[model samples]
Target: MKNKFVQILVTGILVASLPACKQRPDNDAARAKGTGAPTIASTLHFADEHTTATYETAINKFFKNGLFRSGFNGSYLVAKEGKIIAEGYNGFLDPVTKTDSIGEHDAFHLASVSKTFTGMAVLKLWEEGKIGLDDDLSKYFDKFPYPGTTVKMLLSHRSGLPNYTNYLEHYNWDKKKLVTNLDVLTSLYTMHPPLQFPTGKRFSYCNTNYALLALLIEKVSGKAYHVYLEETFFKPLGMTDTYVFSLDKAETAMPSFEWNNRRYGLEFMDLVYGDKNIYSTVRDMLKWDEGLRNGNLFRQSTLDSAFQGYSYEKAGARNYGLGWRLTEVENGKKIVYHNGWWHGNNTVFIRLLEEKATIIVLGNKYNRGIYRSKQLCDIFGDYRQSNKTFQELENESSNGLAAGGSQ
Candidate 1:
């Protein structure tokens, strides 16, 4: 029975990766326009068509052996240049109902991957001169407990601010009611939890850093967090399926599940933004990846600042950037990526800038194999061939895979 299930899953993934039986009108119009650009759905930016197919074959086989055999459940998308090489979705959207299976358009809770958008929003506002990276948190939130923490510190995880989720876990808050970002800030001021370390001490990953950023976005943009992101990033970039999820819409949104098929229930922490709570599809995330690479969203200097490691004091090749994590690989090629785990949802998004490749895997059924999505990078470039390079990547992968759901 297990072998039969694996065979069926492999067949499903290949079917999902195959081109549609009929071309749509938009694809026809795109080809007619003669710009040589693919339609949004068919975006393929590879240099050579045959090579793209070859990589797709290897990638598909990897998924077959790595994920399908292990009972991985979620969405997988691998794209080169601007074109998708291979992509597919597997498993149940709701385990109880078992009625609605995962589909290409289904959006999963992005978890911490939402930080990429939150980080970009901060940069966007900074570039527009509405806010400054060095400006103190007090400038936006009058009672922002930490006086020295700045927007840049928050973006790069250098603030040393204690994670709000940790504080909330111990506090006697009414989980029945959704806790807002303002509540998070209020808790810091009222409860007066000690900082993890002094400001600018070193890199410390904290959810509070992004919670404050969401509040800052609201302060600077004069719009709700979700509205600001939709107007500034989603709509502009044609990411129709992406949105900052809200509690009121929980019933309608896609649900996340644990390995034993139990639903991951929501808590008061669900209300907070920035650190998590964005739901998006693979295609929409691809649009985001492309926008960041092509300088469509921000100036080249802004992206450069966002990509470089802010903490040199750290020993490892790993460093935290604005919204992305930078893993300095061999040959000075930095791998910009982020992994997210909230509830039962786990996601790995890797951007290989030099190769112009993207590996995105989002799983709602709590499979650790999702993190193995990074191994897909081995096929795209020579970065994974060396024993030293492979060892370094393996080390980084261990830390990322072990990261808790709050991250």
Candidate 2:
């Protein structure tokens, strides 16, 4: 059973990674066209084409093989055209506490993927006329380098700013040291030089883009990043569990575990959360995914711009939009995705716009969740709606004489 699932996962990953999607973002937001970009959902789609029994077979195979280890467990939810079709959770929540961290219900850390929330927060502020897409970022920066960077440029990661010098270059940051939000700004201003590329000139993934934007959220809104997200996005949408966490002390936020010959839980958490502690359960994430797809958080017109991809060059691999990733998958299918990693915990959010389906896989290791998500996508490939039973999976396991897990 494990072998079959692993094979499905590996094959799925190879197949999915082969092609790059083409993305186009409206460079001029000032125009009435309002960031003209490709639509996210297909005009027509079959429910079964998004997810089906075949994909269920693949998903079952993934879960049966102890897909997530170190108790690096996960929660999975599949929805079709704004309806909940399937949801499940597996793995351990607290090793010391021995909690059952199920999927689609329990929250986990989003890591950098939390940037998605940050992105939404920024956009919310913009919609309220509290901020502008093209406002000079440095005008409010405590001690900024480039004075002309805009919110739009930062959202598209086109600001050309350096991310983190103190943490990245310093090597041994004293964990005991309290790295205030201002500390981050000081580090960037002092260590990193001018923007990597001219504003609105190119594409590069930089955390500084959002980290600085986090400040903008505070400066313009008169609220902390965490508080702003809670009020504008989370509270409004009823995401009771999700929040912008700034871990002051070592608190029990993300649960850790070891699996598939790796320690996934804590180390993975660190990467996603940085040193600051932040958390969310799988359940909260499922709610988030649902809200994003259903447009519960933003107007259709607004979300259209938020999820669209922007690129500097006219023709190349697709680029990133404000907070979402836009790409086209196999057979001209459009896929929107974003991933989170922190303290050894990882999660992947995969939404196939053509099918109007969403796939979420969160794990403890680096490659595990990504691998499973792609494989699950392949099995589901073009499937729209899925109908399968756990008993069927059990029967497959029994007849195949297989038990998953790398031996």
Candidate 3:
């Protein structure tokens, strides 16, 4: 009878302390032990009531009016500490009918932002010891033309690969038919064209890096690239609506747009995977951001490798990480992000680490204003804008090569 009373008392105490314990800081050691692997320590600084109100007001006033005037059309979400503070949508899913208004359920093509997913997938494999970061392409593809290029170089955009799209004019191919990653690889391996720069020379963002990475993922896993992503990341994470675009669905898929409301039809290039072709909703993307933050998929060290800048000799506040673009301010704060442009879609996914904020703006209509989504970071802290990145990418995108380069 005494032992039962003692057990009840202990249970009561445990229940009473649960809420308070949850509020305590999760340090690295605690998180590692709790998750049974490396996990990111929460630096989430919750916005006070006053701060949240201020941010809400700023977002509404600045984005709502300014974006509409600038012809912005798509879904936007601003979140902190896994809670959304502000979200807005102003666009039509079917531009012809002008009836289906863009909503939370609508999924936009992620375009270049898909690279982040590919990057994380590779890191997961690397963490598993199935692949090495420094392993050469020759290890996987015995016929790969480039000998010295390592997997790490491709991840960091230092591989100096030439954009494959540039050769489309010279290579004879069916324009109406879709091109596969293997097709691109075969062309590069046969042509043996001059690279944009020497291997491991400097930062030159190219879609070829990811195209090869996708092939590498397939070669190593013995599964299709899309299959691996679905089995490994999407299904487990409960991202029911998120998926790689399929040609069968292209006829009924959501269409892209120009600022003038001109619709852009699906092209053969839509078949590619690594650099583009991801489709997801704002809520699902927020779930992805949270997954990375919580270290649900990869170890904290693997994730840290994705954000760490590998090209320091370059002249700029901006640097290219494994699959994402990074900007380091003088204050030592880092802004991790990736932007996408394909057809008429223009998107930005910004992760504010120290402030624990995420700004994701995905527009199916062609509008440079979506790049201004980074300005949302000013509310969290003094974020130095990557003016060159936005302008150069926007300019280059006019020719169909985005910062991520559809080629």
Candidate 4:
């Protein structure tokens, strides 16, 4: 499937004058001075030629030895200091026959990574004084079964709401009916499923949290969740290839396939948007990373709240932030990331906050190897000194050892 490789290295000496976007503090007033829309970073600081070459070589080697060898069928991009040091697209749009080649513009289903967008949208509204983080769910949805569950609880995955997918499947929802965000909320009200735990007692990654958040966004903004995102984020950030998925757009969206090359048919749960169903290309995802870093879409305080850990009942490196997964590694370094798996699409969006590095991998064909892309973080920083080697960590993750809290 490695039929084509595209590697772009910024060929220039280091420019001393370019402002480091990562170092800038988030300023909402500055963002409001303009059209009040987020702007993608136009000028980026490029690593020196030697550093760029080193990163490019290491990334290519990693791809050849790991992901590509495992039949990876999507696109990947690696950027350092805000410049794209390496990127490539492999495999065909149709997995079975090697026909049309995947390109930079191709969009893959983001699955759980979609939660990041959902989470940030909620926070954006909060920043605008449109909603309250501590506001109870009942304040928006009158019949919301959980009384004390707040928007913050939902963002942190501490809502204790049962996952709608599990309850819908076990409770015998009609297979013929496609479920929407409203349907999920209605089911919660009508079925009145018991909470997985008391609200805010512990961290429980539930898709229902974000699903209801989608409803909250609609109620407060008077716009559909997808429409709001398109207008507020995607269009503003110049993420032309990114969007929340809808059935009407099914024909144009990339299709997913099983590991063995079997296509996945749409099922009853395919229509939901908040918990999953975002489609985007690697380029667009990088723009999102840059937008967040440049303080165009959110204030630094909001970003801080989003990245802050909420649940501490258990002691471990893993923790859930508002919409991201945090790994407090050695040297006080934090890796903020999100991995997604839905049907056969496996995606990874990782941001090395301190290092100003971003790793994005999106694949339509099921490949556990995609999750192992985290090991590549060592190429940019000192994340390899842990007790477990990257290979060992990869094996554990691929074997479901790390699947418990992962989406």
Tens-digit lDDT track of model 1 for 215-267: 89998999999999999999988898898888787888888888888887777
- How high is each candidate's TM-score? 0.84, 0.70, 0.81, 0.84
What would you estimate as the lDDT of candidate 1? Answer: 0.75
What is the RMSD of candidate 3?
A: 15.2
Tell me the whole-model lDDT of each prediction, alpha carbons only. 0.75, 0.55, 0.73, 0.78
Tens-place lDDT digits, model 4, residues 208-228: 988888889899999999899
Q: Give the Cα error of residue 403 in candidate 3, in Å.
A: 34
Off by over 4 Å in 4: 1-48, 385-407
Scored by lDDT, model 3 comes in at: 0.73
The 10-residue segment of model 4 with minimum total lDDT is 16-25
Residue 343 Cα positional deviation in candidate 2, in Å, after optimal superposition:
3.2
Ranking by lDDT: 4, 1, 3, 2
Instruction: Write one digit per residue (lDDT tens) for candidate 2, span 1-407.
Output: 12222222212212242132111123222123332111111111223522333244445455554453323355555555544334444434443343332323345666566777778778878778788887786667754677677888888888887656334445455555555556667766665555677777888877767777777888888987777777766776667766555443236454544444344432211422222234665445556766776766677767778877788486643558887766644345556777765545677777776566667666543444343454455433442222434344434534542223232
> Which residue pairs collide, candidate 3?
none
Where does candidate 4 clash, by residue pair?
Answer: none
The runs of at least 3 residues in candidate 3 whose Cα sits more than 4 Å from the true structure, single-residue gaps closed, are: 1-51, 386-407
Model 3 C-alpha lDDT per residue in residues 1-407, reported as the tens digit of each score? 11110000011123242231122123332323332110111122234444343454445544534565676667777788776665555546755556565655668999999999998888888999989999988899886798789999988989988877666546666787788898878878777778888899888888888988999999888898999999988888778778888888787667898877788877666787898888997777888888888877878888888999999985677998999999888778899999999989999999998888899888888999888888767666767563333334333434433111123
